[model samples]
Target chain A: MRTFSRNNLSFIILMLLPALLLVTIFVYYPSIATLISSFTNENLRIPSSGKFVWFLNYTQLLMKPEFWQVTGRSLLIVACTLPLEILIGFLIALLLNENFPGRGIVRALVILPWILPPVVNGFLWNWLLNGEFGALNGLMYQFGLIDKYVFWLQHPSAQIFWTVIVQTWTRFAFPMIILLAGLQSIPQELHEAAAIDGANRIQQLFKVTIPLLTPSLAVAIMVEFISAFQIFDIVWTLTAGGNVGQVINPYTKTLMVFNYQMVFRDMKIGMGSALSYLIMMMSMIVGVFILRNLYNRGVDK
Target chain B: MKTIMKKSVRYLLLYTGAFVALIWALAPIYWIIVSSISTRTELLSKPYKHWIPTHPTLQNFIDVFTTGQKYRAGGTLPTSELLISGLRNSMVISVSVAVLVTIVALLAGYVFARMKFQLKDPVFFYIMLLMPLPIWVSLVSLYFMMTRLGLTDSNLGLILILGTMALPLAVLLMATFIRDLPYEIEEAAFIDGASRWQTLWLVIFPLVLPGASSAFLVSFLNTWNAYMIPMIFSNTEKSQTITVVLSLFIGQYEVAWEQMAAATVFVMIPPILLALFFQRYLVRGLSMGAVKG
Candidate 1:
């Protein structure tokens, strides 16, 4: 029996080996390498063995005005989109939670935008919002809403606003699903008790529903905050990373886009590595809170 | 009369909200389909002619499938070959990553779910921490690593990278599903004198098929939709995915709206079908780690 138990331990180790090895090489190793590379002078454009620069990249990055601008823009995007996503998500989830004919079908169809590739969503919106021959302009003209077509992606501010809109469109379904699950798990008896106490629907929602839905809402916000901070795919396809030329559109360049230009286009590998760590640290701050929440919930369970 | 009015108001609000939801979800999809089928002349016309296409055609989709087609503005439509190859590469990568990640995650998930081990909680927690680490943090090093190993521009490279990207979630999902199962069955298998391997394969495997399928579908969709990794890693047509190829269509000197729409439609079909058919599993898999305990 001792030998058999020993064999079972080996079997368990063998089962976990492949996943462990993959995660170590792909996930953990690259992370450590990025940290190490950030301290070195690694430039792909310059043919030189990268030597330890030790704080040069970080100091340079911190001093750049563009760095602060891009970081601010990324945060602004999170601020603008998170509330809208949560609000619309909550409203839709509430609407969907009520009994109706074809509720399931509506629920399924609503997730269409979420499931479509983010790149495809970007292109789809680009076509619709095109200035010269856009469907949006056509619809507005026909409805007498506008006298002429407008170049939607022309101005930098408009570009940023549209990015927020498209981001909301692509992402709202996720929160809706999370919140819907939260709503379903809330015992119907709570609402019933509230109603018996002469509470109105709005009162019950504020008194009971909102309070119960906090955990799911927190999960949605944290996850969306991370995604919105790392906004790349939509921005890349929508505005061409602000047209990818001599002057990158300052308004539209978020952190990931800035990192891409730094690493890929500029080939400033060292600076890009530093930027990557900065982005990771910002995200990790949020991630730590999320893990704490998960840990607390796990303990309760 | 007041009761009737209140009830009517409730129904009115519900249906109105549902109508708006449908339009919100389906309008962009509908517009893309409309754009894809419209004639190039009609699509290019400045002022709108019709909300619905007056004369729809499938030429754009045909152009996507066929090679050597000429653009209306007189340049060779170079995307057909690229798009087709992209589609094939995407399929190969997504399918392979799905199978590979699913099998690996299932093994790890089972061990975490059923086995006793030292430092198990810490190990599992460490893996879960990888979940929130944005992919950009390691992309630079990954790029260098892939290039050093000569894995760039290769489907296998993407399969490996994308499989790792999908791993943490798949493992969590599989573990969640496995944990929900009754322990009595495994105990009964043990009492039958079956080896651990035999019990895992014959007893646990069949029971966890649903979880496996969920993990597979999620991984498949994620790989199919992955852009940044494939974009950086696979620059050549050899391994560029449909998403990457479609991205190349935009920001040109003269954008091809009709054909781009067609390609967008083509890329959307699989995920739409998956969402429609396996919604229960998709929702369960997606919301696994975030919402559930």
Candidate 2:
């Protein structure tokens, strides 16, 4: 610290001040403002009088029919994706981590879905699920499996199903990578020691691998859950039509997407701000829940 | 016999799992490559949808770049001046935001990591807590903030929003990576009269370039795919981005499935190719959790 010259200190200070100021104004201040907005009826215009409405927004959100339904649907998708992603991700990561042939290629190939832009995921799935021209039907036809091309994104059930699969595809590679790191970090000797004591592979996995992987798995679940809950693009891409409420719950469309619709489509700035605040609060609750649950496990250890 | 049977089942399960994941991973990509090379008639062709094009061509790619004003019908992709400007605007915003965010986060990250400031622990947790909300929510409020400040419809307004959006993750990540840096190296630099900026630029920056790179890439991806923020603040021809232009595919009356797909593939390529090259870093970065810092 003593070696730093005044010029050097000032230069670094100058480099950082603009960014810090930006964060304060844009990030921090707005965050506080959102908390305030959630309680009021502030719309397209900011308050002329700093009007404060109590828990009106939160209470209104609770009564909205679209709200609970969307939460349920979001939960359904998260429920479906989380365990399978963990199990499938764990097994696949294990195989790829094995000192086997073409391991590097396998690792690289598995991560392909992660790098594509979110919009592309939307478009690619759009083509695959295209009723007439989609590749999915083509592949099924090639195998003589189906006589007709299914309009996968048209039917509500099919739409939700495809959205889950697409979202899972885009996300699973992420958890796999994390769990693999956790797996590889564990020393091989633990398994060897357990095996010498007459434990079988199943026992070793249940007793050693699973417990050791718990912290990593917890982190993976937290990431997957938070991401899954806010999922928008896949849904928006699939049925950005009159279907937001008809096909799915209003909120399942994502707090962000809902904000877009409210602000841009409906042109209700106050309601949109209200929606954004709700989203921030919901995500914060989820985030805190994850931290408590996961870190508690660590603390228990 | 029992042991052999068990080994076979384990191998079978492993192979089955791997194959299923591989299919899920490959389908959309195969669709992208095939669609990129297909003709319009071929795309709309009948039964047994060609999984692979019978006659591969780069016509779609050419059409994407060359097609004049997106011929919007009742419902279709916006093929107007907005599209071209949107493309250029995306390139500018994503790259510039990535650079500005990365550079700023570098110093803040270093300070947070090495400076031993008060409330650092609480602040770091606060950043992590703030990370989960969809960025659009941030933009909705920020748009109002910008409007109040009279900064809407300007590129700098966007740069400011996107830069701040990138910082929390950048600072958190930069701090952790900097923590792992050998304190001795900085001490050596200091003892040798290497000023703080000199040490940061010459020594620390090089050491944590990966963190910077990862942060920059995240910033780029956020700005690149961002739809809502840009849509609200820069709905004008001069300011909006590729995502908004593409969303025109969803306008109520018409849907341009083909051209929209074409537009999508165009915007999709740079980031996908970027991910392909940096997939290693991005994954490593994501897994670190600290990488988001």
Candidate 3:
């Protein structure tokens, strides 16, 4: 043990240094810095009196209608997009899981959209959603479904609806890939045994597949929710902050957008810091809820 | 008899589904390719443009590249010189961030994975805990830090943020890969009078490079496609990202449909190609990470 320690101790420390530096500076420091700034009115571009305001920023933010509106909009989009992605992803996963020719090629094709830079996906959909000279509009007019172009982003409902569609496309590949793994992991013998006991395919799916795949589904959803909350790039690119920095879907703003406007647009750095903390607070709330529920589950078990 | 036919036909249905899925996914991309060929005059002539153009031309690509006209937020377009320099800036930021993160993550991740320490487990958990927070939560505060360091619009400023964000997951993944490697090789080197640094350099890093390479790929992808940090830091041509520049084509009065589509496809390659090449290990790593959790 002493020999091992003497031989590798510094090398071990050297390996730890990069991660430690990265975490301390970028992750831990910025988060704590945000926590500190949440209380002050400094918005300090240069060094000034870092005088404390003691939750005044938080109070002012809570009073703003725009803040509440953006929060509501984020929740509404999450509610709409999350379940549909899970359902569609599950179906796609099952379809891909079946033994067939060119299965590897098919899986590769399915993963394509997910790997697209959020910018590419957003731009891809922007053309498809265009009112004039867009492929979708041209097709719709050809089929006599409409006499003229449908202004997609102008209307609140179409923008939000289409945002859901775009978000779904960008994100669905993740859950499908994860779900495919989960489906492949299930024992084939269980299905074979169930078939002999007079169980049908649908019954076997519900009885065996769904329950067993819950953990993977949970991971996929976790990624989706966290990413969905950060759904800035697609929305920003597709809608260009959508008419005074509001979401095209549901006619609201998000914490990220709100903060962007506050700091970069309005140059109100104090309020921007406040908005950042609010977002952090909401994430903590979700994290704590998940943890408490997990604990309760453990106790119950 | 019905059961036998149904069973036989199921395989046929799977192939059909596979074909349809590929077509649906490829359709939009194909439309972009076809539209990018048309003259602006031909594109504007009729309400219903041909799926394949009549006077197929590269005029729009020229206009987008040379004319400097981009869609403004309120719909009327603006003449801006943002395209060429923006592309240069993005390339610089993405490639630099990728190289830097790979080296740092390689060193740190090797340590976390192989070396024993008192705080190692908790420190690793801390990295995971920080992963799920939407990074925008820290954007405002970090902006201040960048400003304090005089890095606000610099490529270095953006690279620092990008490299930092990529570290946590890269290290976590590195740790897992390192832990899986056998210890006997390193132990043998120790007995042969090799110094600790010598053992790490000569023995460990080479054996585990593929996993580090995977982490590098993931890190590079994150930075290459990133828009928000660049969006906030610099909108000027010198430091703007490809994603931010593409959005300039989206305006209130009009959408530069063809140009945006063309630009989007151009910027999509680095990350998508990375995934395509490294897919075998990436998919396996993703699965193992999920199961481990």
Candidate 4:
């Protein structure tokens, strides 16, 4: 490494200026402001100046039934979707790791849902779930699976279930691709070793493949859960109500949606900021835990 | 003969699994394309529902582009000027944000990869911390800040907002890419007395162009697909993006499934094309952050 000379210092300062300035002006400043404002009583609709009311917003959130419901719904979606996504992702990764005809095209096609804009993905699924003239209904009716069209988005529980499906559809490719990379990196000699020891395919998979895949799998799960927790656009386009829309059904909304509702519908900026902080707090706890785990693993190595 | 039969059966099962996977991935897309091409009559008819449109038309695409027409359910096509302006706004913001983010992130990433500087680890740590904070957390204060600065409903505001969101990942990815480059090349440039700035632009930049371009592409797609920033930052046609408009279509009095599908295809084409072309860089860059961090 180059020593810290005057010229080197100046160059570093000059090069880092644009990024640092932007991050500060836009990200750091706003985040700090949100943190500070979260403590006060601020309302967007009424013009009264906010006065300091420490912990009130957080306490109110704790007291609110809707808040608990939204938090629970967020966890439920993650719990339901993450495992299926990981399992399917692992299966697809295993499949793709093998040599097959047109495998390249299949790999590209699998990523299509992930690449498409969330709003577009949401709308595509919304159309598929439409009660009046949905493709799912058409196919189901053709196959004699259902006698009538299903209103998939009208009810709260129904909305929650379909939203999880749409999210899983669009997002599973992330884990699949990452895990595929992980699988490919495992040395072929290990499989040879297992075969020499009379270990069959299933045994090799359980003993060799999975243990080797733990690191990437952990990374994939952490990344997936984090992104899923903050999901907004897909849910927004899929089931959020119209402007001046009524209170969101308790079953269907996530923390981000509740955050939006408080800010826009309830016009409670302080509570909204508080909710944002809570979301950040949850993300930070998980993020820090993952980082610590990675750090410990690195140290062990 | 028995071995041959077993092999054939295995191939059949493999192909069957592949076929199921393909259908799972492509069915929704095919349905959208089918909807985009079908007319109101075919879209509603039960017999036409299960099969491809016998009479396909590009009227929806043409309408979306030329007349700003959006399909409405059980109603005549409505000319949506918002669609046109939103496309324009989205393109402008996405392109500008991409360029700006690439330049900024490359600079910072280059320094971090190569330089020995004070507070380096701390600065990088700060940026990494910013990564996990969701956009909604920042939206409240960003709205306040942008409105206070009178940058609301403007292209520049949207660019700043989205650019900030894209910076951390781009920088991290770029830094990793640059770090992997051959160090001797930069050393040779330095020995020739190219100076630091000249070395970065002339020597290092071209070597990392592929990495930088991928960074630009990812940043562009992220900004293009962003909904919350544009939804809150820009209220009018002058600044609203494709995503905001597409979402509003859902809440419209008459939802035009065909036109919505058409507009969706239009909005998705650029990113899809970019993703296809830059698949190599994207796969590497995306997984790098996950595995490395």
Candidate 5:
């Protein structure tokens, strides 16, 4: 190994400074600032009152029924979509992993939703759910499934349903790609060996394939969970603060929407920062747990 | 005969699954395209045939590009100048961020991968922790900071904000690619008495050019599509992005669906083209991040 001289050490430090400075300024500094501000009365309007209040924001936020309800909706959305994404993503991955004509086209199409600008995805769904000109309602009417336009976004449950549908549409491709790569990485001989031992396809999938794909599954789960938790764009454009903001419908409000409403709409910068820290902690805890298992599985090895 | 029957059944299931996946992915996109081409009357008609519009026309496209007239079911409405500036702003910000990220990530990634230094492991861990850390946590603080610095509503500010947003992942991605470079090449360069900087520039950087380009494309797509930051900071037409402008097209009284779809088509073109062009790199990049994690 070449010995590292003082000059070389300085050179490495110099090269690393830009990234370090940027991250420190933007990522670390802001993150620490959020933690610090969460404890204070750092209102955007009342900068003079930005005093350290010592857990007051946290306590107050926890006590807000409105906040809890939004949190519940966020969880509900994630719970509904996580399993569906995993199962759907796995099935698609299995399909794409197979050898067939037009497989490339199919793969590209599958990832298209993931690749498109998410704001556009939200808008596309908005148009599709429009009561007057929505393709969905029109299709239903043409098929004699409904007698009239449903005004899907007006109803709370329907809003949640449509939001989750659009979320699934856009996000499932990520897990699919990850899981498909995982499936491809698995050695073919393991399946052959299972086959030689009189295992059926389903049995082989359960015994060999799933166990081997666990790491990928963990990754998919982590990505899906974090994304679903932070889902804003789809809900924002689809319902705009949800049915609650529109018609006092309560079910469609999520933490992300709730935060936006609080910070920008409500102008409660201190409380919003507190909520942001809360969200960050929740995601970090779950992320740490999943990543620990992923590393423990020795998957990266 | 039994095995043959089972094989055929399996193939049938596979094809059916593939078909469903394709339709599920493409249906919304197809609907928007159809909506963009069809007139408002056609779209609102009872039991509208959405698969293929009865009167397919390019008028919506023409309106979006030339006249800024939003074709609505009610009438032709004037499109805001925000749409034009939004596209221009998005292009400038995305390109600048991509270029900035590419250069910064390359240099930092090289140092992290090749250098031996104190506190390297901890710094690296902190950087990696940022990969999944949500940006909303910092948004409130960042907004206040930007406002104080007089950086709000400016292209430079947005670029800085967006570039930093993308930096963590970019660094990790570049480091992975650089770390994978053959050790012997660098060793040979060192043995030939090339300095460390000389070796990186002459030997390592050239080898990792593909990785640099991947970083560039990824950063471009991300910053280009970013919604919340631009929505928060760039409230004016001068700096609003395509995503923000498109969201505004959905007005309170009536939504101009056809024109929104037309604008949607325009907004998607850059990322789609980039993705198609860099298809292989994208796949490899995604898989590398996944597997390495």
Candidate 6:
């Protein structure tokens, strides 16, 4: 048995070898190197192995108004879009949960927006919302809502508003799926019991359904919060990162977009690395808080 | 009469909600498809002439697929050659990442599920920690490493990065699948003098085929849909994926809506088909960890 156990150990090590190497090289090493590089004066254009300059990058970034604007914009996107996504997702989930004709097909179709590559969603919306020849403008005009075409993406505030709508469209399906699963798991008897106790549908929904659905909602919120906070790809494609020569769009520069410009465009590797850590730290803090809430809620139940 | 009215209203509300959901889910896609099949004249006409094109044409799609043809929108647009090459590159990278990641994930997943190693718990926890760290956090360091290794603008570089990105989830999914399998099969194989490696291939492999395919499909869709990594890592035509190529259509002077829409449709077809056909696996693979947690 001892010899067999020894042989099994070697097999285990062999099996685990590839995953360990890949994760270390790709995930762990880069993460650690990012932390170290954050302290250096690394610049891609500068050709030298950058020297350590502790907190210089952090201090400089903290002082920059552009940094705050970008960070604030990212947070604002999360604030604006998270609730819309959750509410729409919850409402859709509730509607889908009830049996109807072709419910299966409708559920399948609902995943379309979520599955489409976010870049494609951006392009699709851009086409739909184009100033000169957009379908939206045409429809609104035919309906006599507006005589002149509204250039949706041109104005800054409108740009932010549309960004939120596009994001919600692309993402709400995920929370819907999660919430649908949550709903299915709640026993039918719970609703029956509520009805027997003289609770109306709305009352049962508030008293029984909402309380039971909190965990799934929490999970969905955490995932969506992180996703929205790290918004990229869509914003990039939507605004084309704001013209060629510019560093970033003043209106829609989220953190990831800002990091892209700093690291890839400006070649300011040190500043970008610092920004990366800060973004990671913020996400981690929020993530841990939500997780603790989830854990405590679980314990209580 | 009151009860009937209430029941009728409930059904009315449900169907109305379903109708709105359907339209919300599909309108953008429908518009893209309409635009793809519409002529340049129809697309650019003020107050757009028709809800569905009066004169729909497949010319845009043909122009997208045919090589070396200059797009109708004229000067300096992405030639058909670039879009086709981009599609090819995407296919290669996605397939390679899916296969390689699944194999590695399966091996790792099996050990984590069945082995009783001293470091198992710590290693698993470490991986879980890495899962939520956004890819942007490592973008800079990874760029430097890839550049140093001469891996920038290469297929292998993308496959490696994307595979690594997909690993933790793939591992977790595979582990869950394997844990559900009874261990007696493995025990029987071992008692028959088969090696652990042999038992894995000959016994466990067949049992976990469904899980493996789910992992493969999810990874494939993820790699195919990846834009940011490919956009940064792959600079040249040789390695640029469809998403990167499609992005070039925008930000151009006098944007070619028709051609861009056609390309978008082409790029969307594979993922849309996969999602529709194997949605069960997709939903399971995507939501498994969160729901389990």
Chain B TM, every candidate: 0.93, 0.84, 0.84, 0.91, 0.89, 0.91
Cα lDDT, model 4, residue B285: 59
Which lDDT value does model 2 have at A246? 32
Using lDDT as the measure, which candidate wins?
1
Instruction: Estimate, for each residue in B1-293, the C-alpha lDDT of model 2 and write its tens digit.
Output: 99999788877766776677677788688677767677667777768566667888766555556664454432344464556777888888889998988887777767655664345455445545456655655565676779889788777888778767777666656766777778888878888888666888899989998878877887787688776567668756567788766665445212344555566677777777767688766665555561222
Per-residue accuracy of model 4 over A70-112 as CA lDDT, tens digit each: 8989999999889988888888888889877888888887788
Candidate 2: give its CA RMSD in angstroms.
Answer: 4.6
* lDDT value, residue A118 of candidate 5: 79
Residue B128 miss distance in model 1 (angstroms): 1.7
DockQ per candidate: 0.56, 0.43, 0.43, 0.50, 0.50, 0.52
Instruction: Give DockQ: model 2.
Output: 0.43
Highest TM-score scorer: 1
lDDT of every predicted structure (CA atoms): 0.85, 0.69, 0.70, 0.80, 0.79, 0.84
Query: Between which residue pairs do clashes occur in model 1?
Result: none
- Cand. 3 TM to true fold: 0.88
- Model 3's C-alpha root-mean-square deviation from the true structure amounts to 4.4
Q: Please report, as a residue range, the 10-residue window in candidate 6 chain B with the lowest summed lDDT.
A: B68-77
In model 2, what is the error at residue B163, expressed in angstroms? Answer: 1.8
Candidate 3 ranges beyond 4 A from true positions: A6-9, A43-51, A240-252, A285-301, B1-4, B41-46, B54-63, B66-81, B252-256, B282-288, B291-293
Error of 5 at B102 (Å): 1.2
* Candidate 6 local lDDT, B125-201, one digit each (tens): 56556567878777789888999999999999999998999887788878878877898888888778888778899
Interface RMSD values for the candidates, listed in order? Answer: 2.9, 5.0, 5.0, 3.6, 3.7, 4.0
After the best TM-score superposition of candidate 6, give how far the Cα of residue A136 lies from its true spot, in angstroms.
Answer: 0.8
Give the DockQ (C-alpha) for candidate 1: 0.56
Better of 3 and 5 by lDDT: 5
How many steric overlaps does candidate 4 have? 2
Over B209-242, each residue of candidate 3 has an lDDT whose tens digit, in order, gives 8777777677767777787777777745667777
CAPRI quality of model 1: medium
Candidate number with greatest DockQ: 1
Give per-residue lDDT, candidate 5, residue A44: 66
DockQ score of candidate 5? 0.50
- Deviating ranges (above 4 Å) for candidate 6: A1-7, A46-49, A242-247, A288-301, B1-10, B67-78
